[model samples]
Target: MTGISGGGVMTERKKKYGGLRSGQTIAICLAGLATLWISSGAVTQTPDKGAEESRAARGDQKILVRVRESVSQVRQSYVTVFGRTEAVKKVNIAAETEGQVIARNIMKGAWIKKGQAILQIAMNDRGAHLSDAEAKFEYQRLAYASATKLSKKQFQSRIRVAEVLSNFESAKSELAEIRLDIHRTTVRAPINGYIETFPVGVGDYLQTGEIVATVVNLNPIRVVAHVSEREVTKLRVGDKARILLAEGVKREGEIKYVARIGEQETRTFRVEVWFSNSKKVIPEGLTAELKLKTARKHAHKVSPAVLTLNDEGIIGVKAVNKDKSVIFYPVQIMEDTNEGVWLIGLPPRLTIITVGQEFVQVGQTVRTSRDEVELKGNSTDFNSVKSAS
Candidate 1:
């Protein structure tokens, strides 16, 4: 009985000890699982740490930017004005005498030279009358000479001498009238030009001062434009100009005239540019654009996007110093064009901020990158824009 009792107590102790060992093993497993879960979370956070390492620091983030270097260039400035082409001169050929046009050689739209005959008239009794007047005048002249000699010797009365003198003067006047009529029979061109209109034809009767033809001279064609009061002062006579016609014709010319007085209604002055049109290729009344050179300047060419206004509404651009610190400069526009703007009032050499300029203020140190020009476009990749190697 004692041996049985001892065995039973020993078995009970063994069972309790085994239960304790199992509980310890389970607790250890639970701890191991918790540790593994925590380790997995730490592994997931590694990417965030790496991202933080690559990112810019608090103050240092403000220091990097994209900038462009301003290069000085000699630029030509021009003032563009819209205008129209005009003929140098227009003329009207008129009849000098009354006559019937027997033969007509004029052709409208044909070239004509000075003294070129455009018509012919029938010669009637004028020529015969001219001869008859000359013969009578000669006879009267001889008679007058005889009468004057006789009077000098007191051979005849003074009345006869006076009558002969009157007859001679009458005859001379008659002859001159006939010659004038004969010369006026034929009409001629008075200038070198094109016959714009020829209303008279064969057998057409024309009176004195009647319109026969119209002509125009286009050589040295004129372009007429108007300049505003603000621009007229900068323009002068004989300044260089270029004319672009609507027909795709481009002609170089010089400013021939600038009106001193402004137009009352428009407040603009009339200006004229003369272009050589020896070929008569440019026609009158075509729309034209004239570019007149105003001045030449040493300036920097930049995109118009760089222009900005300060707090006081002063127009300027932002630039960077040698140390890559931001700076603000007031600039005057030397010229503004569709392609670009030429700016003045900056240092000879400048490092202007092209992108992120508005974000930074003056005196701030910023990182910079060069211009990465995309082909034929204005879009920029600022992040990828790094200074050229």
Candidate 2:
């Protein structure tokens, strides 16, 4: 009975140990499964983190900017210059003979034609002198005729006939002098123009070669401008130009003269444009602006805000290529208007960066948001672009 009890106790202890070993195996498996679930959760979050990192890298690569798709239009290029109006011709009328002024025919500012009498000088003894000279001329003519008849008949000596002929010529010269003196008493206009100044009036004594009046012709007025050497070569004598005068008055004129040589001091060529002033309303020395069309070209109109400078300090605009790479194109300002600045020397079609151009660099890849460019009568208006998401 002692042997049986010892064996039972040992068997019972072995069973208990076996049960403990099974429980330990189960706990180890459960711990392993929990570890696998945690690893799977980490693996699941890895893809999200990688996606976030990828998006952040992409956002850093491209810079957002506003752009405008530009289509160049045909435009006329012009060279503008400041100038002033000038009279075509001016004359200073002088007295031809010494006399006392008796009557003034025209007013100080009257328009007079050629040969119109301006002032009348007193005759004085000119009429009496003319009559005396005429009588003497007739007497000498009769004596010369008698002597010539006698000389032809060989009855008078050659010396006497020569003397008589000399007397007749002398008297004829005297009569002509008297007639000329009488005629010179009236001062006439030398050209068809308006009298700008009349220094002398009625009862004013005048000497020969004294200034009596100043006449200026304004039928075809002229605008005189100085142009640079680069612009002078494109101008022709028949080219048309527009002139802006005081009070916003604009007139069309034809190029009349362009200097072949430049001025020594300023190195500028002189240009003249002629236009009609039929009413004589346009005065001389008035300020003017000349707009001379040089040529027709393709141009794009953009706001001044779109202009930028390159690394080399060149004035240009930033554009995007087909591949969305930033590009710099040098541009020349064709004109500046109230609406926008017209730019030339650009591609016929372009995608120009409007905003955030300064933040970008040449040859850099960019993301662009498009803005609308509205056109209204040669003016460009840019609409705001929305922020990129």
Highest TM-score: give the candidate number: 2
Q: List where candidate 2 sits over 4 angstroms from the true fold.
A: 1-76, 156-163, 293-298, 301-305, 308-314, 337-340, 354-361, 368-389
Instruction: List the candidate 1 regions with Cα displacement exceeding 4 Å.
Output: 1-60, 71-76, 122-132, 148-163, 295-298, 303-318, 321-340, 344-349, 354-365, 370-389
Clashing pairs in 1: 63-366, 63-367, 64-367, 65-367
Lowest lDDT block of 10, candidate 1: 380-389
Model 1 per-residue lDDT tens digits across residues 1-389: 99999999999999999999999999999999989998888545435765565443343344455678788887777788999988988888888888788988767899989899888877767789889988988998898899999999999899988999999888888888888888888888888899988888887888889998998999988999998898888897988898888757788999999999999999999999998998888889999999888777788988998888778899999998888888899999877778898898888898888766666678877767776742221123223222110
Error of 2 at 355 (Å): 6.0
After best superposition, candidate 2 residue 110: deviation in angstroms?
2.5
Overall lDDT per candidate, in order of appearance: 0.83, 0.89
Q: Candidate 2's residue-wise lDDT over 93-114, tens digit each? A: 8888888999999998888999
